[model samples]
Target chain A: MKKALSVIMVVVVMFLASFTVVRSASAEEVKITGVITKIEMAADKKSAIAVLKDNKSGESVTITITDDLTLDKFKDHRIVDGDEIRTKFEKEGDKNISKMFKKTAGC
Target chain B: MSGKIITIMLGCALLTTTVQAKEHPGKEQILKDGYQGPKTCEVCHPGKAKEFLGTVHWKHASKADHVDNLNHKEEHGMKNRIYTMCNGNDIVNNLKEIPPNAAGKTKFSGCNTCHPGDHTIDVGSTGPEAEQSIDCLICHSTKYDFRKRKIVKDDKGNVVMTQDRSTEAAANIGRPSIKNCMVCHEAAGGGALVKRGFSMTKEADVHVSKGIICVDCHQAKNHKIPTGRDPNNWASDGIYMTCVGECHSEKPHKDAGINKHTAKIACQTCHIPRTGGAFSKDFTKWEKMSNGFYEPSTLKREVNETAPVYAWYNLTVSNTPHFIGPKGSRTDGKSKIYPFKLFQGKAYYNKKDGQLLSMDFAPPMATGDTLAGVASAAKILGIKDYEPVPGWQTIYFGSNHQVAPKGKALGCANCHSVNGVLNLKELGYSAKEVEKLTTPEIYFEKLLKLQQENE
Candidate 1:
């Protein structure tokens, strides 16, 4: 019984350690500061696409946001066009999925 | 001692302003405590009020650059100029004076509903009060509710436009978006999707589909937005918008024949194929309704994906006595074939002077008394001995928006056949030229040869 309990404890620790590694990998998310040119809300209201003109390069970066927190900000007009934004997104497939979206004008 | 006192006063004023600016709370504080109006914004964006006050949006009039219809020195914009849509006389006649009530509210109706101000001022007026009269949040605040922009009567029985001055709206302030501009522009004929069918919707415009907004092209410089001129539109800042030089190349088409056609055809002539709304005012005739109020008896004409009437336009308007149309012909080298939406209607005119009378029909629509509205308009206009007579009027609006995709452009057979849309003879083409252009076989042979050469 003691040997069996020792094996189970080691297995649980290994699983938690792997989870921590996966969480840290998300730090590879790219950051961009730009002025939002357009924000198109999805018909379902579950997602939105924001086209931002990069402040440095002037190229437009399209980011798809599915997070409810950011979607509520758009719906409530806390975030809007011509606003300077600091965003962090991860490129998944052909889409850039937003992890963080915020206004440079404080909260 | 007086000189020392003056210097001390100036120092205190400067110190006070600096202290206020430094102590100004951030957005978080504004959201929690609620918005405090323009004074709170001025603490950060100084001099913006004065700058905005000088714009045409505030003055409702500006320097005329290309108005050929009226005398430039005498008549300018909304003050003196008239339109087929509504003469705008109601707002002009009822302009509230400067220094509004303690609440900064004024009589708002007609044009004042769209005009941005708490009270009206003189043409060249200035000062702190004038700056305060300017409504910055109307354009800047994303949370600004346009539906709340209603024309209602005050407790004193004076009609006033209600404004959305909610603190919730103030909490979300930013630069004006297309949504702000459309609040007035899209509802020009007093309803949604009515007059001025703007190409801002995804279904109506390719640019919008590609995520293009109005400011991307019509970039407002110092609050002066660049606008294309039209007949009855006199206000101008001398700036113009072009597609080729600004966004597209002069020769955008790959086909040599198609590229050559650009010499005599405007881009909009082919690009914008159709324009109008379900409730677009095609022809309006004010008639007495069963309810006794004078309302428009309209013959609703919708475009509904149809061909637009073609005309040659050289950027000049034919402003004859009681007549207006695009001043261009096929003979003019500088002119190009353009599409226009022809709006026709009946209006009250002076029988003796043969001048079209500007009427404020909004009051009559409610009171059911047509003569009273006319009399009030005439009094404000300083006209003597007016006799109203119904007369026919027409206006040619250029079809400039709702651009179809490039793949849907007019093809060779669309204009080069015998049963083609273009009437060659009516377009000022000579007999021989008409024959040559109408022959589809000859045009196709040439097109085939061009294709073979490319191969």
Candidate 2:
């Protein structure tokens, strides 16, 4: 009876530790900043995709946007190629992505 | 008895001589003889002949192969054997050709009424003298004597050396009158060929204020005479009125400046009255009445004026860092991120119906958004502000402003603001939406009324 109780406690501790590690690894924040390279919309226009490259790291990233994103507010903000963009993202399952914040380009 | 008989016989002989001299040549003989060419006149009137050659009338004659001695071939296999009635048509072949008769020669008697001169008697070195066929001197009287080659001026300042042989020649024999232009331009059966002319047949009835002669607009030098309808011979130069082309330079509009940036808009777009002739209602009527006549009433009047307008918007999505990741094992994990980016599109509207016409999406890169990549990601999750508005996005609009009387620029709130809750609307909206929805407060009550009536 005593041996069985000790074994159960060890199993519980191991389970908790493994759960914590998985959460930490999956939730890591990834920062991507760059000028957008290309943009494309899905065949049905239900989704939009933006290809971006990190300015400092020179790494390319693809961002997928759903149609529900209300884009009409930034009417005055004209977007074009070579605009510097800074974005923050966290791992969603295995993918690192984030909602965009601020964007600036030459007037 | 012998003296009386001799006198009677001489009288009889004189009568017979007079009768024989009066008899004219037959039509066939006359055509065969042909007119003396203009070159014959050039020997005596070189300066006048040069001036005549410069005239469009002379060009028309040449184009029609009207010159008695010159041989011409139609440019595009056009058969020149057909007959036409009008000298205007024959001189330029401006109209379709008529059929030929059995005589093997086109009867030009009616054509000669305008282009008068006997073709049978006057002979050139090569053939018949063309100048003898009602040529330049028929309109412009000359002072030179062909036999003596000396200029002869009449007592009353007339160049009597040459005669005023044309039916429409001016009595003054100096300047060609507006009557000359009116001969063809005026309405037939006492109708004014050019209705805009100043005179009404009688000199006293002339109204100089009405308008000038055809030459003012139709610049005689540029008069395009149609040789044939063939594409090669077609006149490429477009016709212009007095209000257009280089001379006036003044467009008939107050906001002509707009044309500088985008001249593709036709002038008739705004100056609607001038599209047709004077018989049409003058669009300038509004401008004239507004100056002092029509008094503005307290109640607004609705006018049906439609024009096109364009607008744009952007979306940016952001959030605070929350849970790092799902818990599991030993290795440390990064925070999960859901990126968002901006997309742009144009909406058209019909103000009359208060309905959206269509939406044209700009390519994603054209939005010029730095956050486009991340924002695009958020867009996939339906997490941005100002989602597509159905009727308001694209519409045709109208306005009350008399000058620009098109719909005013659409406000940001029309699409971004939440229905019925102003404060909640302001707070729940995105930062881009909050900024756009705040300004240019529209008279919503008036808009509601207008919109209700339109619907």
Among all windows of ten consecutive residues in candidate 1 chain A, which has the lowest summed lDDT? A98-107
Query: How do all models score by TM-score?
Result: 0.67, 0.24
Candidate 1 lDDT for residue B327 = 75
DockQ of 2: 0.00
Q: How close is candidate 1 to the true structure, as a TM-score?
A: 0.67
lDDT of 2 by residue, A23-46 (tens): 886657666767778766667766
lDDT of 2 by residue, B274-374 (tens): 10001111110111111111100111111112221211101111111110111111122321111111111122223344322221111112221213322
Q: Per-model C-alpha lDDT, please?
A: 0.64, 0.30
Off by over 4 Å in 2: A1-107, B1-45, B50-56, B59-113, B116-128, B132-171, B187-211, B219-246, B250-252, B257-455
- Give the per-residue lDDT digits (tens) of candidate 1, residues B1-455: 13443454455445434542342245666667666555667777777778876676666677664545566665366655565555444244343322222243322235445666543433435788767655666776767765455456566755544456667677666546566666556545533344444436666787655455566667778777777655445565556676664456678776777789888888887787776742222113455432233445554333334466777878888764456667778777878888776665566678888777776654555554556656767877788898988777777766777777776666677788888777778778898998888787757787687589989
| DockQ values per model | 0.02, 0.00
Residue B355 of model 2, lDDT score: 28
lDDT value, residue B111 of candidate 1: 46
Using TM-score, give the best candidate's number. Answer: 1
Q: Each prediction's interface RMSD? A: 17.6, 34.7
Give candidate 2's error at residue B67 in angstroms: 24
